[model samples]
Target chain A: MELIVPILAAAVRSGTPILYATLGEIMTEKSGVLNLGLEGIMLIGAYVGFIVTYNTGSPFWGLVAAFFVGMAVNVVHAFLCISLKANQVICGLAMTMFGTGVSSLLGRGYVGETIAGLQAVALPGLSSFPVVGPVFFSQDVMVYISYLLVFVVWFLMYKTKFGLMIRAVGDSPLSAEAAGISVSAVRYASTLLGGGLVSLGGAYLTVVYSHMWVDLMTAGRGWIAVALVIFAIWNPLRAALGSYLFGGVEALQMRIQAGGTTVPAPLLMMLPYILTIAVLVVISVFKGRGRMLGAPSALGLPFYREERE
Target chain B: MRIKVEKRFYITKWQEVCIILASIVLAFSSGALVFHFLGVDPLEAYKMMIDGSLGDFYGVSETVAKTIPLIMCSLAVALSFTMVVWNIGAEGQFVLGALACTAFVRYLYVDNFVVMLACMGISALLAGGLWGAFAGFLKARWNVNEIITTLMMNYVAILLLQYFVYGSWRDPTSLGFPMTPLFPKSARLHQFFSTRVHSGIFFAVIIALILWIVVRKGVWGYEIRVSGQNPKAADYAGIRSTRNVILVMFLSGAIAGLAGMAEMAGLHRRLQPGFAVGYGYTAIIIAWLARLHPLAIIFVSFLFGALFVGGENLQIAMRLPLSSVQILQGLILFFLLGGEFFRNYRVSFISRKR
Candidate 1:
């Protein structure tokens, strides 16, 4: 009971960035595009966001800058995969490498710099409550925005016409085109929107969580978010649940280390990745057994209208 | 006017050469733009990079030393890529191989130089092969995506290596630093002609020759190619894809493992955290650029070796970050992939419909 509150609060705090990335990826995958460049985009965003916030002393402008930069970088991916009909997987890997290089080069001067991070806001009446208030209501404004964004994404994915069109294109681009939907246009829009959100996730890491910039600081969270999309089975609400669960594990690992557990630090660090592999294998097994794996049907395939037989 | 992209039946060799040249040119131009942003003279930077990597004997030897591991890893990636196995776990396999070699050298205490080296090499091969084959088994049995599995395994492998180095394997003499004791002189690889370039180059050459023959002419190679290009047809022809996937991945991993062994025995002579810095990932680009041909991989590895050396030079000489090389590598790959589109399809402009 004593340890529970802090762990829960930490979980929500740690999970925000992952939630952003996962939701953004869900949006992209729903449009039949798989952007494995999330790690790179997040890195670039972290750098750009930190730089902007460091210079302007405003986190909001930093986030806006990150969003635009992410979209701009993703435009290259969109062009390669959609217009040039390059292999999606290869293009994504290239984007990641490119982003890493670009960010590291640009971020050299800003290393070790610090900024005023987003402060937690305690709701007046809600703060007086037990675990729920402290964990949910006493978070930064960005965290609340994340909560609101979750519902917005859920609404956009399930309760809107545009959402239906995104799914239609993902299910079958040919059929969607026949149904009068512009497949390429929809893909471009979703990819860009997803890019912006992913960038925001990176910004959240720099401006809200770390409050300092480091090269490759997002670590493998972007990859975890990618894996989380599959684990969530492509549902927005499940993505939230999955992100929080991962966040909880991360927080618990830190606490265990701080508490000086006998387990090796390296082994403790390996937990999330090992869990990711285990979950991936289990999901694949279910999929192999003819379960309804919620992957977009045309996920990584480039849509070429005239070439289809 | 509107553009129409139509698939081409075949790309002529001349056109292929032109596309390759264009990709190289475009990549350089973009790199130049980046240099200009950094306030460096693009042409001077390029000249310095080229001269630094090739002008001096010391530079040439360093490049060769770098090329030894790169060629082996590139060959490893090329083998699996040929079979479409997607064994992106080379990084993990390489680390495991190094761990295996360190364990052998530390425990066995073999006296004969030749025998000790052979044992270390065998241990690396087996460890890496098993690590890679684990992912292959998952893919074969459960239809799992190898990309994510392999990638996740990299972190696990690195962490496991760190655990050993930081804990039980820490050299008592090194006072708090996380590293293993240096190997005995007999256990270390022999350098050639008074340079840091080791016998690993000979090993790379021999392995490349063997892989080239196996991939280009062997019956198993034919099966791998058939299965990768058309799985249904291969299945109808009675080829076991699952077995092929596992076998190819194991071999691929074993080869990459040799790179780890080379790095330890030839370069570092001890296990440390930064022993293999992204060599495995760099090999992926080399494999793709070489089109999975063993000979081409050798040539591409040398070019990448030069880039690595030059990247270091840039850091020391021009005050540019080492990541500039990574940026160049990324641009080259991006342009190459984009250029592949033109190789397959020809774009034509048509008047827009009113």
Candidate 2:
């Protein structure tokens, strides 16, 4: 029972951060931009949010600060890559570096410190349930928010006209532009919004999970989130499922390590990455070409508005 | 108001040098600004960095010591990039190469210096090339995305290293630290100078020059360039793009693997978990910023090496975070990439939509 509870708790905690990142990535990718800078942006967000929350003693302010910083970084990215039609990969990489560097430079003072963390908000009626109570009902607001965002994004992407336009823009700017839609604007908005959400996820890690600021604290979760985007076939809901599974695997590894299993920590830590590749290989084999997963038709191709189509 | 358009002449060689110099200055200044913000004098911090990296004989030796692996890694990425293979798995290749060379050093009993060097180098090359070829074969055969596959392989390589260090190769006397036993003296790379600068620098330079000649004057280089620039056109021109891509990836991975050997033999003398301080990943940025030009990589790589030394100094002297140095790197990449827009496209404002 003790082992089970800790594992369950670990899974929930681990999954939330990945859930935030994967969902955010799904949104940006839906609009035809592959923001590889999520890792860097998340680091920055985690730092900024932690600093703010520690200073103000309010989680809300911390979240706001993270959102603002994330949005600001996204603005730079959108301007250079989307508006200017520069290389998407390079721009994204730059964003990541910028976010990481800025965060580290500013966050130096906050190292080895703790802050006022978010309180777990138990759902009134749902919290009364037997086994599922702690698993689903009793959790911090960010955990519930991540779950809610998955559905919200799913509905927005699949069932709505706006979602269709976003998809269309990603598919072909020429067609979308001819249909009287602004491709650049939609891309910019989605990129920024996506960036903001990913940063919020980072902030949640610091403010809710660790209540501390540290260097490279996200520890490649950003890359895992990037891989999850592909693994889940760019679907926000599926991405959530993947995150949960990945979180469970990660949690299980930690539990076994804690249990004094002879396996090395590095090998245990590598489980998630190895599993990620395995899952990718299996999905590719079973699905026989995952083209229908809403992969942007013109993903990573820089759009030149003035070029003859 | 209509902005006047300026017509510019062809790009000059001098202009290229100027642009590089400007980039270095801008990147370093931005680095300094971070130090300034952290309550340290930027000038003094930079001085401290210089002092740490190359102010004295020992510092220069250490700087040269660090530069060899960097140059090799940069060359690895730069060479493959010419074929547009985008092999971002150099870090893994490096680790694999080190592992292979170390394995030879550990198990082998009789070894002359020359034979030992040849075996270690060959072992590294073979290991890295095989891994690189695996990624290439997947791309050619199944149409797998090389980026994702190569990246995934990196994790596999890292895990393999970690497993060995922590499991089979755990140093007996180190009190549970994840590292291997030290190599025999014969397996170690000979230092060129007393200051700790190893012969790896000479090897890297020679390799860079050879790559420059191959990319510039060789027929195979021509094929690689044609394919990288435009695959469809290369195919239409009767070039086997697939073979070239595979060949280049193999060569790239092999060179990166050699860098791993250099790190093990010249510096560390043993393998550990954090053996590579991200030299492979940083090489990607270096390759691109150098425009994937083999000759250009020499200057670009030295600049990066300086930044590494300088960044370390900034950390110690100014208490600036390590991430700030990475941020400067990102800014350089950003400006270079952003600069490419002007290189490739012209921006014009049309009348507002009525």
Candidate 3:
């Protein structure tokens, strides 16, 4: 019981960045554009965020810069996949490569640099509560914002009229166009918004989590976030839960390694990826039976208006 | 006036060349903008890159040595991509191949040079093939997504390699660095006098030639192309796509495994953590850039090898990050992907109809 609070706290802290990425990808996938460049975008965001904060001395400005950088990168993706109607998979992979290369190149100067990170804020009334307070309320401002963003994304995805348009576009762009919805506009906006959120997640890693710059620091977390969207069946609330679940596994691995357990550290590090694959297989096995198979029908397909049946 | 885009039945060769040239120019200009932002002269840096990679005998030899693995891995990707299997686990398979080769050398200890080399080669092929076949089996049996499964397997293979390198395989005399003891002299590949270029290049060419002939002329090749273009049509014609996917994936993994064996035997002569850097990932780009043609892959791989060598030189000469080359590669791929779209569809400026 004594160890549970710290573990849970670490879970939330580590999970927040993934939550941000998963939520962002959820939005993008909901719009029927699978941007596989999340890992690369996050890397660029981390670099830009760290550089901005290092120069400006404010994490706020750093996050703002990251958001713009991510959007700029995704704009290239949208132009290729949307306007030109290129193969989405290959284009997405290219975007990731570009992001990773450009970020690593530009971030060379900032290696090992340190800055003041965002501090955890204690809520006045909630501070007195024991396990729940420390685990949930006593994280950095970004963590609280992530909690809010989860519900915000959920409401935006399921509640709003705009949400309806995104689903319509994803499910059938032709049908949506027939109803006067601009499929291209919705995809562009969603992809950009998703990019912004992913960048914010990257900023959080630099400003709040690591508080320093490193190349390839996101380290495949973006890929895991992509898998998380599938695991959550594209629901934002489930995405939050899934991200924390992965975070819990990551935290447990660190704690065990620190505790001097006999298990090899590399083996422990393989947990999340192995689990992700297992879950993907299970999802595939149970596919087409019910609502559990929640992939967007038109996901990963390029939209074309003139093609005949 | 307005612009109209229409799909073309076939793009002319001259137009294709023009599009490729235009993409190259655009990519270079963007790279130049980046270089300018970083306070370096783009032309000077590019000149240095060329000189560093291909100017001297030493540079040329290094580039050739690098091309061995690139050629093998690119062929691996191209073969599976021919069937649309998406075997992104070549990196993992490569590592496993290296590990398998190392294990045979370290534990089996055959004295005859020819037999030992043969054993290592076969071990690598079998290990890589089996590893690849696992993903193919999953896809065949359960309809799983090969992209994610293969990607996940890459991490597993790397971690498994790390476990051995850091644990029982660590050389006792090396002062605690995470590496295995060097293989015996007989186990090493025969290199040309005073240069790193080894017999692996010969093996690569032979294998590529074999694969090219098989893919172009063999019955299996016909079946694969048929299944890839239209699986339902192939099914109607009595072609079994599931068997083809598994077989193609195994062969693909085997070729990548050979790449791993080549790198281990030719370059390092010992197992190390960072032995195979991003060759497998880069092969994906090379395969696409070469249009999945094995013969074209060889020349493309050499060009990429030069780019990698030049990237390393940039770190020393201009104080630029080695990732500068990666950025250039990425930009080139982006332009190429975009260019493929324009190749299929021609955009023309037409007067607006009133």
Strongest candidate by DockQ = 1
**Model 3 agreement with the true structure over A1-309: per-residue lDDT tens digits:** 788889999999989999999999999999899888888889988888899999999988998899898888899888888887877777777777888888887888788999887889987788569899988988888998999999999999889999999988888888998999998999999999999899888888899999999998987788888888888889999999999998898888888999998888889889988988887778767773333466778887788777644
lDDT of 2 by residue, B288-339 (tens): 8888877777777776777788777777776666665687788788767666
DockQ for all candidate structures vs. native: 0.76, 0.54, 0.64
- Candidate 1: where is the Cα deviation over 4 Å? A289-292, B350-354
CA deviation > 4 Å runs, candidate 2:
A1-9, A286-293, B3-21, B38-40, B54-58, B175-178, B235-244, B347-354
Could you tell me the lDDT of residue B279 within candidate 3?
Answer: 86
Native contacts present in candidate 2, fraction: 0.60
Q: Which has the greatest lDDT?
A: 1
lDDT value, candidate 1, whole model: 0.88
TM-score to true structure, per model:
0.97, 0.92, 0.96
Interface RMSD of each: 1.3, 2.4, 1.9
Model 2 chain B: weakest 10-residue lDDT segment is: B1-10
Worst 10 residues of 3 chain B by lDDT: B140-149
Candidate 2 contains a number of clashing pairs equal to: 0
Per-candidate RMSD vs. true structure? 1.9, 3.1, 1.9
> Ten residues in a row with the worst lDDT in model 1 chain A?
A286-295
